[model samples]
Target: MTSTPPDDFDAVVGAAPSAVTTPTLEHTAEHAAEPRGSRFDDWWARTVYTPARQRLWYWGAPLAVTLLAAVLRLWNLGNPHVLVFDETFYVKDSYTLMHLGYEASWPADADTKFNAGDTDIFTSAPSFVAHPPFGKWMISLGLAVFGAGNSVGWRISTAIVGILAVVLVMLIARRLFRSTLVATIAGLLMAVDGHAIVMSRVALLDGSVMFLALLAFGCLLLDRGWFQRRLDAKVARRRLAGGPADWGPTLWWRPWLLTAAVLLGLCSGVKWSGLYFLAFFAVYVVVVDAVARRRAGIPFWISASILKQGPATFLLMVPLALVTYIATWTGWLVTSGGYYRHWAQTDGQPWAGALNWVPLWFQNLWHYQTAMYGYSINLHVPHPYQANPLTWLFMIRPTSMYYAGSSLGQNGCASANCSSAITSIGNPLIWWAAAACAFYLVYRLARYREWKVGLILMGLAAGYLPWLLYTGRTVFQFYTIAFEPYLILGLAFVISLIIGTRTDAAWRRKRGLLVTAIFLAFVLAISVFFYPLWTGQQVPFWYWQLHIWLPSWR
Candidate 1:
């Protein structure tokens, strides 16, 4: 203390070193203002070892992964020399509609002749068919482009759309999970699934339904994001102004929602059952909006959404869908001989306009819908392959699309006892694991509030559970395409848990990643093993026999 007292004799320095002091309070504010990590904060650094190279993981890897998926799906698309499954119905309907301008009745015993490459059996005049022509419309496009090319023509549409679906899976999974790895995983899984591939190679409505449902689902996801962002910006503005945010924030009219509506209309145009997804998703969008409002701390959010947002959403979705559905009937409306085409001209009519050319026929369509409803709801026929929702996971008694035995030396015969057939079986590893994953999801929904668990549950519910209630109706597991995208989502969710969301403790994270890699490898391997059956390849009878793990599979 004595040594520090000099400063220009009185002030050599403004203050002696011993007298100088720093304040302990300076760091108080820094400590208070520092950001404490939420559980996700340490995710990337802890789990993703490549820190400076994060961009490569998202963009570059997905492109590479998608290529792998494409090769698996697109190669050897033509195998079965004959139409597989219901390719007979949709493919032939497409041709009949194209040639006749409407569905024409077939001569008795037409299939034997038609399958013989003789197209002369379809008769003139309208044939009363149950389903609308839009699905056939799409099938016709494929045939027109790729006609009678055998496997090429019959399966072209499904193959192309299946490829497109892989692209969609990448986009949806990337957006939902925000991880490129998760998206690539989803795409790869979809690409390798035996059911999806078999369905793709055959002309069927379920693949188209899958496409439309996936499109609408993607749109709803986009709309939810847009709505939430609009809320956030409004909240930020209010906070900056030092005032509580107003409850009514202006929302942009969402075209994606409209796109979703129109796609659903097209879906309904294909099959009336598509309306179920439209109804469920329409209500789902409103609930999502309400939640977004509540999370933004908007008081009276329920009424705010119900009164202001709900009507606009409905107008944009349901009624617009109704209008589009009616538009799908334009061809029928123009034709007088359509099955119910005379409703307006019938002697006693409830709604009048026949003389105006718009006709009571339009009104009669309402009555026709009632009849269609009865047929769908009251259908209770038992069949060998009529599997219940409880057993769908196992892929037992899978639907056989086509079966014929060729004597040795005829077409595909590697054995003295020749066998040639096509069976629409699922990839056992992927589906079985999905079942286990879904079982886990069901458990977690009761115990933990996981977003993936709940969202995936909706799709499975809409597609599978509804069928359970309608078990009295003729239903099949092949219809599961309605929910395949979400099933993939559920699988991706489990993958996410295994990978620990790009962040986790060292041991847990390592184990999770190992499991994901192992599962993916196993799934791809299974796809290769089943590629013969999926594509109708002419493997030896014994080679085909290798895939029939169960006696029921026969």
Candidate 2:
């Protein structure tokens, strides 16, 4: 049966006709012609078309899930008391940055002093930190508010960003699937995932990177809608004016894309690895632009998209990201005391001659970036916990951030030699199932040409594939935290497929719903079982052993 289009499909495209438009729904002939008998098909169409219900659930449901996520992250956030894993570097750096406006070098025993509740452990000299300073600045914001002496202050920002990430995943899933129910499932999955929970509670740069990258991805999704609206409006205007409407109108101003550029820049600011996202998104948006023009009947859509429009889009996105990235170094840029801040003056570098006209601060900033790049590429130092990128998906090795063994009488240990640990493991069910689902998504994307599956795949590729090139380097599985949401999203998308559209045969829909519920229940149960490990709660030795399913997990 041919189901009806949403009543407001045209209204969404033409709501701001002067600013945006779409060709008729008929323009997407291939997608429109696909048969839709499944219950999912009917529900998705209604959710997409019913503006009132969409508005109600989109923010309302996702925000509720985010609240649940926040409670989980914030509760017992200060438990570890002492610095854990990379927090030894980041939390102290944040404390220093808060007081001095730049990261300062610490004495060899800085960790000892700081962990003992003595916060003044820094020296007068600047620290030669590898990553950019903005992430530390965010940590410093929390420290400044809550007093750097406390563990909660060190972790609060990460927790907040982590919760916000859940909201972003929900919104992005909603936009991709056009179903609030699926979006809620994605958000809830993220909310409870052990990896996300652990990252949130620890003062690490990766959580901030995850939040910014996810935010940028959300902006790109919004931009897709924004661009489509403009495309439809242009076609509508031309036809009404009795002008040729075969070719789509050119879109020069894309504020949402610009917004995405800024967020992507911030993602890079958190970690240079975010550069991959910038590269992926730049290509993704331009291709999307070209496809929009093609669907609107442009005879030269390829030339129009690649030539006429591509360069302008690149100019708007790439350079803006560069500027935003530079802006993130504002503290280091203005200060004369950061390490290598005087490289141009001291080293007499040859590049200085060409850049002599530029301000000394900027020249030195360039020199610092060069030094950072050198340090990054050549970093092959061995780490005990470092796992190859190949095993990150399988989670063959999870980094242990904090671990302690307790006797029967100490620290509320209920058994002989109980254990408390914070292990950066994902929810096993979610990670294992999603890893399997990702393969299916690849087939769906290629064979069925499913756009949503493509989005999930692109995210995973941008976040995961880049690591494959650096496996010889000292990368860790914790880095997977950056792309874990996309994996969850792929899993949710498949589950939505299984739930089949409301128009499908009753038995098929019932079975699909039952299977989906069982899968989610198992995921939640795994999360509960692993929660103690995620939050550093002590559990019986045997219980911990049972949670460790694979031998490598040890």
Candidate 3:
């Protein structure tokens, strides 16, 4: 008789079960002598045969967590009603981009005038912006819908993207760990984390980069599974034809990879740091393909993947990404008044000979891009909240985006002094714990060689490691928002290990569950404590001081 599969079986093994089969003793013996074409048959079987009832949790759980994220990001979004931190640049630029088709130069008193409802203070002359226009275009959508002077309008698009990011994290975690509970834990952490909260609530380009990079990561994860299934089928066909598995077939039709390329291009269009993700993940894809081929018993897996398939993958991803990146400048490209829009025709020399055929507009764009790159790399201006990337993961020196003080009788203040502030600080327990978990994951990846662990670490590396080269370039801890999702995912992975398996001793299972519950409760409690600071909520000056655990945070 065949037995029922355990509900938590996938949780323990980190993958779906192979197809279940009930066969006679004689039939089982006969099949044991035959060669199987591929190892993924069981995975396909389990997937195809999954109960309809179990599938509801797949969408249901993630959507619930995303609802929590929406509430946190959208509540009182217009509080303080002023340009906070870098919003002085992004929000004003977005307002002008909506009106003028590109970022236009604003007068010295533009913020004061714009805040006082004089929203039309920009000139037609282009501003030399450090970042690209895609993120600003997104912000322009919100400004268009709600009017430019409304603070909620200034930040609604980012809030929505932030909510969607929480759902993506849940879905990706579900795929990686094969556990809905673990996935929910990851989403909850991101939902309540103060850094994610502040980044979502403010109008900044980094939030767009974070969401796009994460969406690209999700696409890549989907591609990994799709590639494996297709490779298995092809390998099975070859083995059935009595052929040697010398090299795997090159599979070119990858929709997820193509989607990822476009997303990464748009990401880079928002902020150039997004290119680091594309570069890192491209290498990761080639490595994963080699391993997949090796697992399918290909004798020449390494050379076949590196030499034969690598070029094909590059052709599929890089050129498409470049095209997409250029397409993001449509507004600037078509318009005449953008910064350096006619440089090649006037101030700069255009290419001669064969390259002379290139359009003056295209050459002008190239010149403008190079200038933007030079400015970004060489920037060393000092600011009070500028943080070293080395201390980012620890939440030391969190950036203060906005702050206002009130006397006892002003603005509903009840204490001798009151404070309302927006601090981009992560919850202390969650951040410190996630940091410790990330270090442990590095060891776990080395010891066990789990692809999921490597993938999570790669996400962290893509968002973070590149910044180390520019420590002198005036970066801030708030930039950590880009990789903060991966940190929560890493934390979730460790939590899975702590929760143990249903197969473990009853006492062990109970202890694990109890511990996880207590930890989550504390995380929730800390989120409540810090929510006031994360938003610009007024509190007693001493109470606000209590929330600052470290001197550096102030």
Candidate 4:
């Protein structure tokens, strides 16, 4: 991607024109022709895409880099030889769903047999699992091939999706910031980050949620770019060639946004939390569209954006999500013998025969859903490691997913001291800085009305802040997986800021980037250094203790 320096004074490059370009309006006039993607086409489209004129590397390099991430995440994979965290739930459930057509309960120690490649004891009954079946269905895809014997069966799908997510984030960051360097950095950070790594290795519903939600987010960004391009092209055709171009650009059936909605619904199908992000982003898309329309100077932009954009987002997300969500319950629908297979028939509700001959089991499933919703909202249990969302940014507490007893000699500990632990502690270097960045984002959002700040805040709010509303819940630190991607992105955004301001002197800016790069290198080194502890690698006690930066970490 060879190109010239994009100086603030180089005409049509800065919000604040260079002192040199000030006395002469020559520079601004020339860049006005540059369009979205770079400094060449309709240059005045600063608020939108800038057409790229210089040499640029394609997606090949990003793909290769993503493969490297996959190697790290998927290698070994089945160590500790046990379900690390919620794998206990998702892995076993997925196996039953595949074998029995519904999630059925297993013995208390079923993980031991399942780990040892023995699933013969699992029954052929519909299990009363809480979550929707999509995530389990995915897990079962791997188990069906790998046979639920080891972590490979449970984890391979998630690990693959996790690495693919890195690729998606890179592609997304590349488009959003218009910087290959930023995109690579985001991918590189995700490659080794603790939360992404740990979650990938465990067969957890949250990781699936993370993958689908992030996928949807990525798709919407692309959809935004595609929509704007069509809008501009349509407007140009009308103004230049003379036609009404009435309906404000045909962006009716946005495929990517629809993909996002299906993914979002599936995400909620995995867990109810996806509903919040779906609701938020649906509105977010419409608002972004309206603003883009207004800026483009369409005569009836307001009505057009609402009428055209709003309904499509609704159609894509709400109904599509509902359908996908319902489909996840088909296993319950078809089954005659379930946990609550006859509640409506026995209790004899008015709508008991509403879908007459639909089977009493199906009616009981609906009743179970009503009861489940009640339980989820009214949950008020307190917990020991229950962290406040307020403290999430600080990495003050991390969940220990596994710990076992063994002598130092038995587990290869150097001085008769043995310790085996899989903790969900985040990279301190990245997280501590992100907390400061969060405050900075808050200030910038209020001052400049920057959309970047708002996006980060919204993600964090949906992931972290909402927990404030449920301070009474018995949540654990491992729940951070829900929002860890945004946290990582927040850190990456701050690092971009550290890479020097466009307003800084050229030499100073270069130096700032150098320092930032070195800082990121250290963070990467730390991730690799602690990889042993993050996964259940057998390391000496003293070696493990060295990684414990605080007493709480120990």
For candidate 1, write residues 51-93 as lDDT tens digits. 4355555556667766765665667666654656677677777
Candidate 4's TM-score: 0.83
110: Cα error in model 4, Å: 2.4
Q: Cα lDDT of all candidates, in order?
A: 0.71, 0.82, 0.87, 0.70
Q: Identify the runs in model 1 with alpha carbons over 4 angstroms from their true place.
A: 1-60, 64-73, 148-151, 234-252, 346-358, 445-452, 501-503
**lDDT, candidate 1, at 496:** 73
Which lDDT value does model 4 have at 397?
A: 71
Per-residue lDDT tens digits for candidate 3, residues 1-554, read 01222255336344212477899999878766654422232443455366654455555666788889999999999987888888999999998887878899999988888887788878999999999999999998999999987999999999988888888888788778777778888999999999999999999999999999999999999899899899989999999999877877898999999999999999999999989999998998999899999988899999989997798889888999999999999999888899999898788899899999999888999999999999999889999999998888888899999999999999999999999999998988899999999999898888778888899999999999999998888999999989999999999988887776655445566677789889999999999999999999999999999987889888
Q: Model 4 scores what on Cα lDDT? A: 0.70
Model 4 scores worst on lDDT over the 10 consecutive residues at 7-16
Residue by residue across 312-349, what tens digits does model 4's lDDT show? 76877799888887777776667655556666766556
Regions of candidate 4 where Cα sits further than 4 Å from its true position: 1-61, 231-251, 298-309, 346-365, 500-504
TM-score of each: 0.83, 0.88, 0.91, 0.83
lDDT of 1 at 111: 62
| Candidate No. with top TM-score | 3
Worst 10 residues of 2 by lDDT: 8-17
Q: Kindly give the stretch of ten consecutive residues in candidate 1 with the minimal lDDT sum.
A: 7-16
Q: Write the per-residue lDDT of candidate 2 for residues 378-455, one digit (tens) a residue.
A: 999998888999989899999989999898989999798799999999998888989998988887777766566777
